[model samples]
Target: MRIRKKRSLLNQAAGGDGLRRVVRKAYGVFRREGLAGIKTRIAWLRAGAPGTVDPRRYGEWVRCFDQIDDATRAVIRERVANFENPPRISVVMPVYNPNPQWLAQAIESIRAQLYPHWELCIADDVSTDPAIRPLLDRHASADARIKVAFREKNGHISAASNTALGLATGAWVALFDHDDVLPEHALYCVADAIQRNPEIRMIYSDEDKIDESGKRREPYFKCDWNPDLFLSQNMFSHLGVFQKDLLDEVGGFREGYEGSQDYDLALRCAERAGGGAIHHIPRVLYHWRVHAESTASGTDAKPYAVVAGERALNDHLDRTGIRGTAEFELNGYRVRYALPDPAPLVSLIIPTRNEPELVRECIKSIVDKTTYRNFEIIVVDSGSGDPATLGSIASLEHDEVVRVLRDDRPFNFSAWCNSAIEASNGDIVGLIDNGIEVITPGWLSEMVSIALQPGVGAVGAKVLYPNDTVQHAGFALGLLGMAGRVHHHLPRGSFGYFGRASLRCTVSAVSAACMIVRKSVYRDTAGLNEKDTSMAFSDVDFCIRVREAGYRNVWTPYAELYHHESATRRDDSDLAMQARFDKEVQYMRTRWGSLLRDDPFYSPNLTFDEENFGLAWPPRVGALV
Candidate 1:
């Protein structure tokens, strides 16, 4: 009996050892192949275990592996060697009085870049620090790439950057702040991108936030580069890489935009580049150091930053000949516009099939909430099975405020919207989905404010779920497949992974759910594509065309709405809907390849599951509910 018990104990020990081996091997596979590999491992283990391993426990194990794998990959990329024959890049960094050690560290990080063919052009704007000169000289002596240029008189950052720009001889110019660090592969990655896409005059990459200790805190902006968005917000962090010629063409950076000089330069470049050809490398290549002295760190510290951003925005408007006003204040913050008049007789167009209740709510919201009173609600019905819908419309007391148009051809969202717009009388047109409910009282005023901005041709409202979580903040090209879903529900007011507002962004496309467009722009873009007769990406197609016509498409958070997201129409056949969605996606991919592929607003980090259904149960309840 004792011998048998000893053998049993020995067998148990062996089994434990075997389990460790399996776990280690599983982790190894996960590290190499990511989540997919861990899933495969879970299946393999389950197949062997049968009732021994609980499916729930196995899933937990897989999750562990995935986290480990992601961390491993991040570490590998952070340490990876860069390209061979690294192209020469001149980084123009401007410094005022920055932390001595932190500034030294920032310069040192540049020196540590894997790419050898790069120069650090440090332009000091008469820094108050007495110790700065010796430290700059010490680093310059250590590395040939480091060159220090100081202004005897204070010229501020804009002048300092230009001074460095004048010295840049490299093929590519990368703008950096004195407190920011270039990841080891920043120059190398830029060089690789330039070599790959010769036609691209500028390339911007993703960036991360680092604290004063130089420890990476979080990724600020993770989406791909978007030019239309570049107009409204400076999406490209760590500045960006510009072809020296292109930089010179735009006359370097504008002077008045002292805090947001880089933003001004990017907008000017986008205007010059026209559309397409600008590249956004999705990887996090730049590290923006956040300290007490960082402009974004304190409100008092960067009052000029906001002013500079506003100035840059105005400059883009002026340069592009975009008709709009700037510094127009509403609800405390300044809202810029191009239109002189507020009550321009906007025609609110509603395209619906059978949503009588929704139509009533939508029309009522327009009448009740809109600050600008000169507007007409025009409902274009495709075909409604419910006779009550027609009855409800007939029963409305204000017949003068409501007009109904009929289309019997087919259930095409785009076609219906176009028909409504055609029937409307106003030069300024607003399209709202039947399922949307306006939340803001001055929603129309806010939208028109942006729509009337000099360069803005199209404007979309910030759409929220009925539950109040974000539905569609903005639209981007190329998110059609992996994150092919539109109108993501994000955490309220949570600027996503990249300091990008979960609230506002400019994009190549926006949802027809709540879009405002000028009459001329609507006619100029030839209305929405009628060929896309089904419910898919017709809004995207229209916005792309509008952008092609030299107009900006903007998404404003000021105009808020609750979108019951396809609630008016139910897709009984999932298979058919998927097929139609796939076809439209393919169409977009083929026709607008560059925009779809390179748009910075397109975030790869957002997977299909995360974007469409949003974050899972429990945790999402507080924010989403």
Candidate 2:
């Protein structure tokens, strides 16, 4: 029988969508060939594996290959031969009834580390398997670096981890599962990061999974320290190393959060050591092992793990004084922040020309679907040539909360939005296009919650096309010269690279079609620039200025809206329109040239030619300063 692919198993485990799924189809492949099969597969991967989703990553690995060559190993040894202050890393391993074969592989991976300054602290939680205790004893006797402790009773994973933590004598402790494997240069990478940034207290690296056949796939190329994304899910699960002092300060891992103990510990550590103390090493250093009973195969392996994770997140929020509640959504969590008391009014501004049908739908969705009560609509109509549009505009006058203002000048989207802003009276303002329709009922509430957060300048919602394809998720600067949406045209319900399309991560900017900005922040940043009469890049310019004023612009997938984008606007195919667009693009390049070249939220290793989030042709090297 032909072997099944890893993706099929992942889809089955994730119920057709696997943001956190690990590869599990290699068991039969590994069993058939044994050790020879594992070696052959890795060799094939180095030779540019066909049908690989991320070929660039494999290509990079082939070049480096964790200093396997004698010459490369010598160079690495020379570099760290006489380090001034080398920090010892304590590997905390909590073991139960792990597969003997896989368990040996895990221990061997640590023994193969290039970095010499480390110790493996293993706590066996009373394994029923008779082979486990003898194996631990043999390894500890052979290697002085290996320390073993046998539990008197079968404590859960949290207690077992705490027991291992007690054995840690190093300044930093790194979490390692008994069944998982580590790269040869994992500790070396950690040491290098520490050498570069000595102040780092918490460090995490990107990771992937190894199938039973030793086929490495499904790499998660994560972003830098993303607090918003952390609240949603445990992005820093693998290769997490924390200062032992910081862990002690947080009182170690809580007992009840068994399956998600690492996530809970990470959150607690983050609460104590923030900003520069938190660091990210964007490289796959850990390889999770996926088996039938492993949590990597499915969350259902430990049903209570999901519940415990939610409780951990809620506790983090309460301790941090963030007024919100976290609830489970698929394989992740969605945080619903409680709206401020006497909710600040949000002025919804829509710029329209004639298109009566589009404008009507936009207004209807806002009135009927929006659940946020403290909001007023301001319609800025620009020279309605059709009498039907005039009637539609006059009809809204009867609604006391909706105000229809006129901009009799030529069609300039920026000027129209500015006019509406001046005429509106609300604590917050939303610049929405006339062709947008609300999809999520709690859209306004989600936007308001984020907008009202401290140091947040603007909040952008996920805008999808009428046919359920993504119109705009968030903007990445330097993409297509000025900026472009990260996951534009991606199918709905599909998460983009590393679940970035679904998670609430920060972006350089977001489209103003359905953006909410605080009135104070808008005034502080001087609102939208009206200089670009063609109206292109106006929203990007506004967001950049907002960030320059020391505020973060955020994009949330929770607040969703269907955007009939460009429905009312004239096509830029004509010579005159194309010339205006060129001018607008040129104006943006002139004003923010340096910023357009580099976007902090986006990684340098990613492609700028397209928004596919694929690895660049020549991946960036060295540490990000």
Candidate 3:
């Protein structure tokens, strides 16, 4: 080993070719990943790759890819000149007592835009600071596009925003903060996306936080138009844009939700323009200034924002007629859906081979710990030779809620599940593995509430290993060319990556180990694929089919359960099993091409290396379009 190290140093030291190779490799990483990506590669060589990449270093990323050179300005100008009535965006900013330098920088960022079809409308909320009005007047005098409105009385954010909205004449309105900065190409990108997707009425982009020294950090590379996640947190806070008609339709923000005025406005607009009318640009367009008072520093800075956000979310739920209560937890909101008048009967189907102890624990936990009153257990045993296990199964039938199915057939998991569903007498069917045990008493309640929703297909839980580490949060497709668990191996109660693991967001698929689905929809979507995926990939395939049938599969971190997955897991070293696994992979690729490769809930900026929401080394997206 010592000689190899010595030879390596000597080879690089002998000629410039070796050093050139090192520089060339770094340059390649820059083209793929940004400037921080070079440091990521070095860290991997020094201490091995981290479980998740440190997604900071926003300054490096901006310099590497988001640089607006003269050539970029020329392109923007040429593109705008050729357009037919390219949108003139009206940026409305609500102001109070802000730092003078920061306010000047915010106004200057608007003046330096490459896309010239924009107007700035500023409304001052009776600031006590004397510097506010003079600075505003200087800017209004300098540029014909800048509009300033000084409020006579002290109104809050919502009222101030509406005052600024009254001065706007453009077709679209872009929400802005008094101290925040927009990139030179921000308006250009929004206009470009509008031109491409003419039906879209609302749009937002990724954002980051800038400190007093103008250093950027904490970049938030967000997903594409996630409605559930939008309820939890206001991802549309920065770079949030809307059509003037939609803004007017929502009545231009309510006065009560002062701190979370944007969130409330977004919810109302989302109700009007559902999923089909919104677009997301995967680029950092807005920079929120971080200081002692800004929420970007931490939520503790503004406790009122959290409370107002909850109120806004609860009001959104009521407006949509969803019978659910929203509560703030883990830095996001969790909605507890109410069960129907006659609580839907849940039939939990547990398939076992010959494991008696595991089966007994599973059944005992459901009977002892589960708080849900109306449910039954159906144990499907296939060819169990142990007489003692058979005797215990027969004895379990003495209880009215426990039913035993004696099916002495081949070990086909999919076939057993379908047969169990056929024999079950309930409105909802839960496909639970025999090795899983209940951790939370309200586990059944959470799953039933979500699965009982109209368009929701499969509802999964937060499963943990016996050691209290995460076993499965959900399924992320394109993980090593197949599906893998999201937030796998995270310690219990870990709020991963912008609190995604803690939020009930949409997923492409979920594990069958602990999932619940409505019986009517399950049968209509054609329950698991039994022929080609009898053993493996059946759950993912079933979920894909369900999504194709216009039903969304959901995964929640609220329902906690202990999954002894290793006990039921089998090694794939045998040639026959390996061949079958390869065939299933090929079948999935041929059947679902892009959908498997790209998950809507998962970002292209995140890596599939560990499926743990790490920043992709050279993200799938590039600079502004």
Candidate 4:
């Protein structure tokens, strides 16, 4: 005869009192059957009988029973008797037509781990292979930590990942894939990182790519934990241990990102994480399988990967409220900002001695191309004896937009700038050389954005030579005898050693040729030092004071301008220019001392060897060609 378990306690009650009889009946049922039989009977009873209990609470109880077996129950009771905590972890893997041998290898890798405090939850999309079920069963039988759930229907990678994530139960969740191999120390590394930095929400490490025969590949893209690079590209290996709370907060892996889910996750995590919350392990703990089907192979085969990357970038910008246009082309890989609505007031200060044509071109460009609306021009005439230079300033049709300040005391660039600043009413102060010609629209917007960042004291533009070669990418002091030198002269498109068109580095000073400074910093710095005002070392001195006061001086390649070198100060006698240059170098050497002598960016060896000034500046020969 087929035996059926009681569907409800009320039906098995032996007495009239419902509560007391229910307890007695439960005890009798447990006594009559073995643990497995009782579990089967309980499963049947719950299926057949409905309860009015809260669904959430009842579901929790159901999950507890589902995870428990006869041996586990006894162990739990013993642990409770002895007062011990249970080990918990949630291993989430999303599979799509996974190879049986590779899947088995992945499972075996998990089984071989020293820390056996984990559970494996696999979300398998529908596959046509007949060997999958038997293979899964063979592994599941060997270990209770392994659990497999086959979807009734086929889902994409994102949906499959979410399905696996839904089954997590541990305090932490680990992301794993079907074909990847984890080192024996993988779990231990994660545990150690988490233990050290408990406040960190996620941890990732470097990974090696192995071929089909398990041979390591050449030229690996080593993982970097830089947040800036992370936003631009996926520099972190994906197999990371994430806190369950942070995972839930981000709503798990976003769908529709077929191959770039990890990239998307890294960007989102960086956006939400506070300072230093995301961490990196400098060792390779995960082995990525580099087969033909891998996403990193190329975008041609997996076009969706490129799409996903673009989508991730767009989403990051949208979420962060960063307003700029993203350009991904060669020589144009930068985000240029559109002019802000009701643009902030700017005061354009130009110190002129006797350059009429260049100053007129500069003013015309500002009036013609500048999309920014509110701004005034302050021309500090530092003893311009040329009648045409004075006439150009007097010839402005809009006199209301232009103000001329006469400086008859001396030709001090610093003091002239101070006079201009005193005459200006704008919050942002721009100092442009009389020899510069603005070449781009929205140049002011780009400058303003960098200056507006907290703690940023100044922003300078990318000044190019009249021959179209880069003149000054940015300025770095102590680089070449404490004199500020331009960064990239590499034949147009080279990224140089810094891996950027405009390299980001801490500099002793930026040039005052075309720079933007906040009004408050100008006030604080006392408007530059006039002690050495033959225009010799004033910019360097100002930048030093700015840094000493704890402010960052930035150089951006976003704003482009053409510099007519030394148009106002005619030191055309090569000896005079050389003498002036030597004096400035001497001043820097005396001020900075051993710091200038030890700069890595400068090279005495190349300076002696190379005739090319370009190669001599960077100290590395043949790198810029």
Per-candidate TM-score against the hidden true structure: 0.71, 0.86, 0.89, 0.59
What TM-score, to 2 decimals, does candidate 3 have?
A: 0.89
* Candidate 2 clashing pairs, residues 3+ apart or interchain: none
Candidate 4 lDDT by residue in tens digits, 1-625: 0122122223232224535744564564455333533453343333331112233533353354222355644543443344234335577888776777788878887886545667888888876788887787788788888888888888788888888888888877888888877765566556656655778877776555556776543212222344333444465554677777888888888987776787777677767774367766644567777777875443333445654666777777777777754433111124444455767789999877776666777787787766566888887777878787688766753567777887876545777888789879999999888777766555677788767765678777777666655666655444444554544443332333223334333344567888899999988877787654346667777776786687767666557677887545535466865676577656666776655543322333223232122223222212100
Clashing pairs in 3: 32-618, 33-618
Root-mean-square deviation of every model: 17.2, 9.3, 13.5, 22.6
lDDT (C-alpha) at residue 435 in model 4: 75
> Positional deviation of 289 in candidate 3, in angstroms?
1.5
Which parts of model 3 have CA positions greater than 4 angstroms off?
A: 1-59, 566-571
Model 1, C-alpha of 539: deviation from truth (Å) = 3.8
Model 3, residue 581: C-alpha shift (Å): 1.2
Q: Order of all candidates by lDDT, from best down to worst? A: 3, 2, 1, 4
For model 4, which pairs clash? none
**Cα miss at 396, model 4 (Å)?**
7.1
lDDT (CA) for every model shown? 0.66, 0.80, 0.82, 0.62
Task: Give residue 248's lDDT in candidate 2 (0 to 100).
Answer: 94
Instruction: Summarize candidate 2's per-residue lDDT along 153-256 as a digit string, tens digits.
Output: 99899999999999999989999999999988889888888887989999998887777888776666676777777888898789999999999999998898
